[model samples]
Target chain A: MSWLTRAGAAAAVKRNRRAPLLILLLAAVFALAVPRPAPDHVPFGEQQNVETANPLLCVHTLLENEVQEAKIKRSLVLARELGATTIVQFFPWAYHEPSKGRFNWERADRILGHANRQGLQVIARLGLVPAWARPSGPDQPSTLNYLPAESFEDFARYAAAFARRYAEAVKALIIWNEPNLSFEWGYRQVDPAAYARLLRVSYEQVKAANPDMQVLAGALAPTLERRGSAAGLNELEYLSAMYRQGAGDVFDALAIHTYGFRDPPAAEPNRERLNFRRAELLREVMIAHGDGDKPAFITEFGWNDHPRWTSAVRPSQRSAYTIRAYDYAKSNWDWLESLCLWALRYPADLLSYPDNFTLVSADFSKKPIYFALQDYSRQRARSEALWLPPPLDG
Target chain B: MAAAAAGWLKRPIALGLAMLALGAIVAAALVAIIRHAAPPDVRTAFPAGEIVVGVDGSFPPFALDDGETLQGLDIDLARAIARDIDLPARFLNIGYYALHDALISGRVDLLISALRVDPARMDDLRYTASYFDNGFVLITDADDSDANFDALKEARIAYEYASSAESQIRDWEEDGRQLMRRPYELPQYALDALRLEQADAAIVDATTFRLYQSAHMDWSAKSEFISHDPYAIALRIDRVDAWKLVDSALAALKESGELAKIIDRWL
Candidate 1:
């Protein structure tokens, strides 16, 4: 009776072990026989065939404090979250040299230093048009045109010095911003010929300071048509006019500023000229000038989400439109080299005026449009141009 | 509570019968609530009279504080709707986000804050026919000169949380691209970043940028628009009647040429 009971218990243990083994074998067979279905394929609007570069999304930062410092960093962190890689900024001429010949690259150095440490590639535009550069008169805002021809050389010197000092950190130098636009040329007058000279001289100096560094031509503001005021010349006309005025071979890449409005980019009847298609027009002009082979970049282009402002679209619409426009721009990789949006955020008090221009609110609230960008940035890969053929359409 | 109790410890054979009874009771209660909430012809019953609609006055063309008064496209449109409904209209101003809270809390009967119909919001709000379209744009300092998207990888950008701009930015990042720069907010605090030179650029709407430019024409900072936006009126999601009433009112206003006049008055 004892042997029988022991044998029964032993058999029970053996059966328990066999049950587990059988279950394992069954599970393995089931896994092999029925694989999970592949994920559903939703077609992306368009696939990029050209190589795209990854650039950073940047915003202007005002020195306030550690909090402000953290605030700006948070903004950058958000941009990084959206896949921005480079920053385009400025070194204010007025702040750097309030007094003649005395320079304060300390502030500039700190800003640039932090950006570099954060792995941000900076493209500094060296044109604040200091008061010293202007002629003696009532104190007025300094613009690109205000700088005398002599001052252009001085600017070049300063630029050269800055580049030399930060050669390892700073990679690109844009001579000035929107020199073709009257506002940038100085509100007083529009002078392409003079501006060209400034470019020629400044480019030479900047290049001399850093041979390996790439210097971009100043961005040309997009305009409706050729007119009488300072911004009278459309982007293509202004660039061509500058080239006609002998602005050839001054810088490396041609920079442009493009914005699309309610109007279609294509021209129509009755409208003598249309600006909705300013970016395309500028590209056409680049080809006409035989500089079609040159790579083009759009420093700023975007729509507003302001509900109250006259020039703004409803905030809801702004989100939808931004996503579509960005996707379109990204899809058309052949026509664009690099496109940096106008901004990331603005001041709160200025929110009433600058309120609508941000992807997020001044207090760091996430807007619907910002989420759309985050989504796009997450899915998109920057296609690089290993070998791009010269402009064939041109 | 009764229905939940019936669901527990039930015999498999009786489970189906108990579930049916619970469903019938819940349905009966829901029907009773629905009937008591609003009248079927709520719009008609509220005799055409002057109705004051409260709005977040920050939005410009839609609603804004004109220094001393609240006036905007929506204000005028509301007036026109009132007139058609045989009533007068008064404007009450508030903040953008607060407008929604006000409406749901019965502080206001309607909300016109460029509301969009999103799935997540389907439960809390109902929208009328979208009257306008808007798009997001990229904002940068007027002086930025980069030519490619790749150039913006490391820059700082700022946006409001839960805003459309924030979503757009998130979508852009989801493509596995990384920016060296980040996003932030505030120009005055960061003006030093822009002026003394701390930050690179900012992203914002064209109108707000222009408003800032117009105010600070002398400040030397400027913004440009890069993108479109669409808009609609919103009501309490559960108030399907209110939604239909508002939608019909808007349509009637449009047909009577009253909408055009109102739009002209503000926009």
Candidate 2:
């Protein structure tokens, strides 16, 4: 329709060959300047369900920090491959809602989409205070975790939005993580009553949005700090305090954080000791509170194997204890719904002891623990040794 | 004076040279003024007159509590930094995860916990220039011909099974560099395999390699980093004065070779 437009451009280019080069240069610059999405992860394209003999096997995934879609998909794919039927992923309020009323669900949508395609059930763990919700002043230097009481309603609003948006893909919503620790409570005095109030508010809001979505309370951290300690109150005391504050009615299930530390899976737990079986002490507290019928989920549990870290076990023992812990939970804890590991993998290595908690490395290399758990989940017998006995023969 | 000035101004060459010289002098003066004007009030930067340092004292060769007191490279570095800042230093043995909290809460002035400089924490914190690299490295025997990466074309590489070294090997393979991988249960085992000449090369983090070498001082090996995980100090972003002073102290340490001596004393 416009022959002169194209003809004139061709005639001008012929007149000045540098024009074509200049045009190409401009094109290259434009291409480079335009922001590009991380190479879009091609989904599995077919519906896939996790094939597992133990549905209690779950892993908390730190995918909120992942910047690439391909890595997110790969992590979820690995979780599915490991026979994990459920994953506990954080949906930070700060990340989703940077402003008071605004919301950004781009990353959450991608994660849920991939999880759905992989047939993985996601339990969204929500926390972290946005800038608008956090108190700011010259003297008050607050962290992202410094959630004020006034912002509890704002966080509930965010949790409600998240539940409503991904109700189909997500199975449950865990409100807050490790609130028993003072550090998780923004360096303030640990308050169990305050946490229960936040939970109650969030629970009502989330249920109103998606009644089918189960709300879990108190992914309380396991600590030894007593009632007067500045660091934190122990989870047992904190849970009791929550129950007294009427937290038992607000949440449908309980979320607990326990670790094996240096203890074996069968190690007996005591009031003064911490181990894998410390979860039982938490359950007993629930029973005393007359909430024993409510199901519990161990949202964060694992053993660290860092060589220099004081509380860590050996790599072999970490693997053995993890599998044993899963088995023990499946056989003994009928009230427990899921026993999730502390982490699946970090988006990047922290280059510290905490890195030992992951089943996969930052680069996606499956650890021996991953293999061991895969074997346990798939019910495959390990006939061969993991490695050569040693170089002792030399 | 007027006659002399007029005479000098009449000579175009002399006039041009004089103006250029004046301009250079003015520029140098301005640079000196800017650099020296903001001598941070140490009283305001560190009101306690002591640098309270937060460190996870569990990591040996960096910082470890020997049931009496914390000592190691990080501890020494913190003491040296406080000395350079003209303040007495107090140390708090803290958990690794709580290091940042202690700093931000004003409970501690700074953190030197062998922490990798994470970009995500930059929003609320500022990190000093790297003091050490603890990344994965390819270690080969001193006498081995494959000390250089050239032999990786046909090398049987040993590394801790499922560790960062193993992941680095996988990354190399994905980049079209084929490697014969031998994964041991631990990095020490991989180092042992290399020392025994069972493998052409072994890969492990620099910290592990150093600790192993320290245990076997007679064993000679050469290592080069395949990836970089730099450890640095962190301060709250709002503490501009403290950040500036600490950064300069680190630079001074590097310049005087004191930093290298401190690193060598442990690593």
Candidate 3:
């Protein structure tokens, strides 16, 4: 217990007290010196310029849940190889904005970037409400497409954010798809006026964000139900109701889904039957409303070749009818902008009639219809060049 | 004196470090024991003597509801499997798309609604050996000499349009062989064409061919299987004991001739 022992203990205490501080300082220096690895660069910020002979040629691509970037790139590449200059891709709001006021554009950016890189114009459909945006009444179930009327402004903000972000790359945006169907309209009674109001709000917000962006409305599902029916209103009757509710002024163009269930494209258009020419009935509604000058975009249309589906046609018939539908639209419907088919491919097997609508299989194998469409597009391109007059000498 | 003081100070610090290391070692050992411990046996998750089976009741001849009771080949086969495994069968009608979800969510112990073995979903579920082959087969009037694709050259072959059979026929055509392909909207019509002497033979799936043969019983099928699509029972991958039981039951059914009798009842 002498003074020597006491001094040695005191010095040891001092050294030990400095150890933690010294270690922390060295760690901080190391951390600051070593830089973090950069994330893989995603190409963006470029304008998409697509050129093709057939302006009416387009296809819907399922890229929202496509996990692989290579698959997304391949889908767009194959579409372009098939002479399709435009594609209709779904950009679900719930997927992009999972929570309130927060946005994750990682997947959206990859899809849009790859699509733009492949020289394809994307007609982006925006819908699907996040859980937080849905209504919370005792009777209200949280559904993907259910958005309370109070959350319309929040939805508009999302649309505005999207339009502002992709303003350079994408020039067209569709607002809320297939509202005429009860299943699509949150399983509530189909209301054309409410949808028109939704479209008007979205159109104003999108235009404010990007004036150049074309706002598309009325991607209505084709049904034969009459007024007061529970399933849905007839698409023609729904369009008339939309015009009655002043939807004609809010949208730049009308977007219609023209699926020819079992009939060919040349099948006569009747209010009772669903056919490719049913698009004619939709156009007639626009003309009646004096909005005929605005072009119509057939955003979803095709024939399914499912062997078991009652509505499906034969595989060969599907291929033949699809090409004839394109030719019919080009020769007969001058007011049409594009005839994008139902789908190009899905990420996995839907195991239903819906899977049969795809031009390419889930495994990336091209179907016979895909080859048929490609050949048709090539021949049409050649015919178009032949029809073009020689450039006048300067 | 300084050295003695340092020694006294080091003793407590060293003691504290040792205690911390000991605590970490004890914590890691406890964690390992808990993690590697055997989980509760899923085989006994159901009722004491019953196995819950999920079936898509809409697929007729495989699984169907006659508005009161579920009856079909899949139902009888499931019953037979349950009997072999010494468990009572409780069938839960589920949609085709929700079958996998029902199995994974523990709503059902087994799925036997003519489930096809999907390689994509193999990681999530284990499948028993195939009990039925719904593959494409070549059928004739029991008097034809052409027994295979190579022999079917220059022969009129009838197939359902837009069907897997048509795709196979087209593949043969692509391989430099010519087939007088007559397409029908329904497989029954194709077989009818073959029976009516309009076609030399018919290429159709085994299911359609069996159903047609059940009614006619005069048509004979060639032994060559053109395509392979077998139906097997699907169980959750984590149910190790349950999978073993089902696999053994399927094998026993195959060995005892009960599987053939059950299939014959429907076919």
Candidate 4:
């Protein structure tokens, strides 16, 4: 009786351990044998193309935060229908590569696919470091924008991966956005030298992956901040600082953000005043630095029309000034490649003065400026270049 | 008989004192609920000995810097909250994009700008109860009692050509409702059309409609809210003590009717 009871207990214990192992084996085999289906989360409708009269009509779009693929497609359609031939979009590194060596390109694929289908030239802006790449600081946890020196290689690898995958649809890549801003640099002292190193690492990697990829850098914020100020150094001074840090060698083109705030398009450029023609002063900095041969892309620029914002203009004035700003860009700036507006639409209304910067509302309703830009885009011929030849300083 | 009379008197007097004590406790609790006591740790929340508010002073009637002075409904509201907290108020006129960042980085104590209560920002921020609803308002002539959003099957509607009102009307159209739309170049023009009987009803944001009405005091129109976009104050998630002070001050302002008076003075 004792022998039989002891034997049965041992057998039951052994069986309990073997049961989990058996189930795991079966699950592993099942996962391997059955091939997972490709992602078709959103229907890829008919292949479409755009027909636009103005090649310089470009708009920066914020579609990375879009929750629905239908909305992403609809936004790209709106941009193309508005006669914008190009769009600059942000593809956050934290969103795509959340961890080391692992990638989820579903969101990226849908956006690029829809955008390419719509026949729009896409310029990709990459930043927002992944959590694993950001080590906790001494005082507190690091923010998403905090990328350590050790993780620069990891971010470059991710950029190379992006470059290789979307090389067909994307021709240009912006290394970071508003790097001169202390907030964008993770609340630390904004260092152009550190940013130059980041641009170097990313440029080498992405160029190795796709040699033809245009490496753009420095979408500086148009602030009036001075040295030792916390907000950020102004863009004009920031550019000179960047050139001082040997940033000119690593990039193909420069990306600038010039906004018209309480100023007209024809306002004279100064070192202090932030205005639309401020791009001219920035170009002067480039020419002064001997990089005048390189083309520059105005990735983000526009006027706000909110009645209350001190930086805003009237709605009618906003519309007229935006169109005239585009015209001014075409007529004046010779090194300019594309003149993109600040945004097409945000996924949701910011419900502040920033809402007035968009050409379309969150509900997909068009603004009066959309019609203005559309008419302006149509009046010009399709074969026209962005700028007149021989580099006009005026 | 004298002893019995004394016992009866004692019972009633004891019961009367007990009732009075209970009434005092209830009154104190109510006062505690509405008029917040400054936290003992208030110094930790505001070591600067003052309340600093970050406002995007671009929009007028809310908060606008008129070159010589900063004045608006939000400016006065911030002042009243600081007065209730027994602290002097300081304001930083931040830009629209940098408002929340200023609050998070400890540069400002609270944000009193016309910021909507965004659920997305609830992770790092705690919002107080909304003070203003700048939602859309439907404007109809005072005599036109029958016109409203739901009943507008065949009425003529006018709104600013490309404003948020246009989006609402487009949504209504998508739901299979038919109405003749008269898009005006300005919100005031739409109101003018309603005044002239050129349109059956007009739509504009509450703030715009109020500002327009304040200018044209003689015009009478029936107004009803069709949407709600509430504006509230935001504080950092870690600043619970400071948040309580501001929330209680806002509630007191609401109760004392000073908040409405401030809004009326601006509108």
Candidate 5:
């Protein structure tokens, strides 16, 4: 070979040997220069399954936007300590699937994992469509609850994935929240058939994903609006219409939102007055539809005591009425599964009348209702134990 | 290379140019560091040259709309505060429930409604000193010799049935004070009982008493606040400078007796 050619080949061999070392030095410098995120600390260990004494006591936990893991764990622990076996938590589809097909399960997993560890059975309410799922039609405003007709399958797919992912922890799933209210129905005219279709699609998908999951439908808000009103349809008429659309066969259990606005639980139910016993009217509608075999769940029911709100009761009345309502449910309502109170706590101040309905403050301070219910649950447990038949002699 | 650099530095023109470049770089870096290290300006919490105040016009005496114009004690007090701060005051009539949201969402710079200072909202809102007390007070006829509760131990006291005043009277009875408690259907009726000689004294809220006294000048309020629920102005907690300015203005008004004049004008 020529001398120049030989020299070039030797130089190339030397450069190739130094290339990896140079790249390694550069990688080390880059690693030292950039900041790395702190390692994630799993807040909870494996949850111990402990059954609660009061099966009738349930609370709606406002953990949908609670970002802190420690706070989430503490809220669930308090609920379990209050003898609540079931907690109706909102697992919004928009939160989990922010993008079309991509799913971020970090927040959901943290909440579900803590709830499971606290031995709280979750009734996951699924709704709240993502912005991407909302249609870009000129007539529809980009709102939180605006889910167009085409996005039903997309929502169902999210529900199926959520059910399948947390089937072991969450056995009950509420399809939608207060569909009878115009605010919840994307501000469109309240259509029972449309909600029924949404429920049917979700029920089929969830059941297909996890056959053991109990699908709850019809979280109708109690309104006194008559037919053809712009606000909403009366919850009873809406449920009746839902039945007419063959919604009874789709859902495993019926979900009802029965609020005791200013009346006591024993106040007789009327077509015009909204009260706690209004759930009875809903249950009667279910029975008349021949779906009496299915259990009805009070998904949202409570009284607010905000002094300025016209519909609020006194604080003392709220405590007394809440206990009385629970007792009445236990003694009278045989067809009911659980009476989940409207809310346990909020992550922040809602600055509205709904703030007065919470059992605990946003900072996790237990309110009077929390202690009153805890005392009532303990007493009921003792009473039930006393009534238990003596153990048979082996 | 070392000899060449020394030769280049030996020339006065080149050395001056190099030193100038170095000084420029240093000055640029110093400016950048100072800009980065300075604390962010916080006066941007509210819009400039305007002080927006939210008032619930439904509350009478404190803030109410009189057909064509909004007139109340709170309205005048807010205007005075605006004058003191040298800013134009724009009042937004918000509902009582939406008052907190409006302030927090920056829809209004502050609130002058008859909002009680809620401890739960302290984290989100910064409250100035109470402008008025809307709690229950003992009221008697203008000529009653035993005007205060302490002096009227054996006298009959009337309160609205199932009202907070009744509860307070009961609590006092439990504390070993023998009070002849009389009940009326409404607070106005309870005050009317005192006027009509049906009862020696009547316990009613300050708002009710103010409205009643404004209508019938024969009744008079006595005693220190029985149930202390003071109405205060609220602003977003982040508006430190604005809150300081408004709070100082309120303090000056209170010091100058202008607040008392405003309260007396409406009450």
Candidate 6:
């Protein structure tokens, strides 16, 4: 070697020998400072050879002269294509039990009957009080919105009876759409304690009728604002109060409704604060009640076509959000078992109108949301194994 | 010779120890200075420990308040923001309008009240990214023929005070000037003004208007969100540091795909 290079090598060896302790200490610190991989989660639910992972899809029945069995079959097929193993169908009380005691299960029979045959699950939402249920007034107006305030018990009994008979075909029941809402509760005023009582009664009766039946409490519409005459409670406070009033143990799953403005699932620009991590909130309440591990069902959630629903997503956006939501729910398999869109099709009168919350047109033409679901279903069908993301922490 | 070499290594170890001690002292001093310099940006701007975020708990199929608890797009979004930053979110009973002041003077850190950021309230406060947006809609008793804006011009327009709808109406009035006659605020003093039929039509948010229209026979609706403004997280303009922190947190949220997940929970 050259004399200069040999001298340099000797100097480096001397420098290292002089600070051997320092070098060892630095190495120890570095070892401790390195990050470790996050822990993995255990999967839940029916992870067997299922074709679709998503368990909920939006389906609607347009007001018609006659209920079409063909349309029902198409919807089932559509739901199957949309990666949904479950379909949320509205059972408006006005149409079903038009009069007290007397029943007309014709529409439900067709819908639920068909859904059962297709091996798809059905979530039966029971609401829309009939004229006979309303309290008599001096200016006797026969509006279906009002229930015989006293007949709430009778209604529960009827509801339980309905659950008993259809327990085999349809077990999931979402009571009274958005009862926390003033308009949904007949727009006169809201009483949480009263609603809790109703929930307890219905829950008990349904459970008594069929213990195997899954009873999802009514999906509370989101309206934390208590402005003007349109007063409503925040979901957390409402649930807290419900639990306080002993409404916690009434149902199998907590049903929630979620929707965002025109932004995509990734970019919820305007209503970021309003967007709720659906399963997490319910889980929190459940934990508070010492039932943290209970599953949550998103009974009604979808983007609105309302070009101006203050924070509603656009038509294109609706599809993106829907897909992302499905993907997220699938990824986070536990806690969330179902997420039903608000609607499948708009009634003819509301078509082309704002706040258009539908997957299909009045004439049954599919929207982007329909196609998005279909694509997801196809993907799920192709995959041999399924993996979902870990549960979200708010 | 061995003794001399050992001494040399010992000297280097001593020197390294001294440098580390000096570095620790400098770090402590720097931390003290930073703590004193910033002093927690939200001390007065927003309530320090805990604050309430008012939301339309249930405007679902958009926002759903279970009468006591709040969950939905606005509710989930607020919770996520709260978690990222250091705020314990306790939703309050204060309605949509009451929360604005709460945000202004520390009663609350921010109003996740699903408020639309428009030109009218440019002076009130600062707004974060538009989380959600829907068009303005006119909801009326179904029999009422004045569903569209033109037909509803003659009908009395109803809207919440200080709401986005109020601001939009004001903007319209300003543009139209005297030619467009002003619509009455209705009921004189807000006792179920719309319910009392003081206004033939109410200009409400799309989700709400549609929900009412769908659920009630007395309601018919029409909406056009062509100029749909997005809902933004409202914060006081004076709290620059807190605002920056919130913005950064939100940016992180977007990057992590957490924001998208939040939207999925609600929408």
Instruction: Write candidate 4's Cα lDDT for B117-154 as tens digits.
Output: 99999998999999999999999888766776677887
Higher lDDT: candidate 2 or 5?
Answer: 2
Tell me the spans in candidate 4 whose CA falls farther than 4 Å from its real position.
A1-40, A135-143, A148-150, A380-394, B1-40, B66-69, B143-153, B174-178
Q: Comparing 1 and 3 by TM-score, which wins?
A: 3
Q: Model 5 residue A292 lDDT?
A: 89
Question: Which 10 consecutive residues of model 6 chain B have the lowest summed lDDT?
Answer: B182-191
How much of the true contact map at the interface does candidate 3 reproduce, as a fraction?
0.00
- Give the lowest summed-lDDT range of ten residues in model 1 chain A: A385-394
lDDT of 2 by residue, B85-125 (tens): 99999998877777787788778889999999989899889
RMSD of each: 25.0, 7.1, 12.1, 11.7, 14.4, 30.3
Cα lDDT for residue B161, candidate 2: 78
- Segments in model 2 whose C-alpha atoms lie over 4 Å from true places: A1-44, A383-386, B1-39, B66-68, B144-146, B171-179, B255-257
What would the per-residue lDDT of candidate 5 be over residues A338-373, giving only the tens digit for each residue? Answer: 999989988875533467789887766566577778
Per-prediction DockQ: 0.07, 0.44, 0.05, 0.13, 0.03, 0.01
User: Between prediction 1 and prediction 5, which has the larger DockQ?
Assistant: 1
- Off-target runs (Cα >4 Å) in candidate 5 are A1-42, A46-53, A136-140, A380-394, B1-267
Descending-lDDT candidate ranking? 2, 4, 3, 5, 6, 1
Q: Pick the candidate with the highest DockQ.
A: 2
Q: Which order, best to worst by DockQ?
A: 2, 4, 1, 3, 5, 6
DockQ, prediction 3: 0.05
Alpha-carbon TM-score of each model against the true structure: 0.49, 0.86, 0.63, 0.82, 0.60, 0.49
Per-residue lDDT tens digits of candidate 4, residues A246-323? 889999999999999989999998888889888888888999999999999999999988765677887778888998
- lDDT per model, in order? 0.59, 0.88, 0.81, 0.86, 0.80, 0.61
| lDDT agreement of model 2 with the native | 0.88
A212, model 1: CA deviation in Å?
A: 1.8
Instruction: Return the TM-score for candidate 5, rounded to 2 decimals.
Output: 0.60
Better-scoring candidate (DockQ), 3 or 5: 3
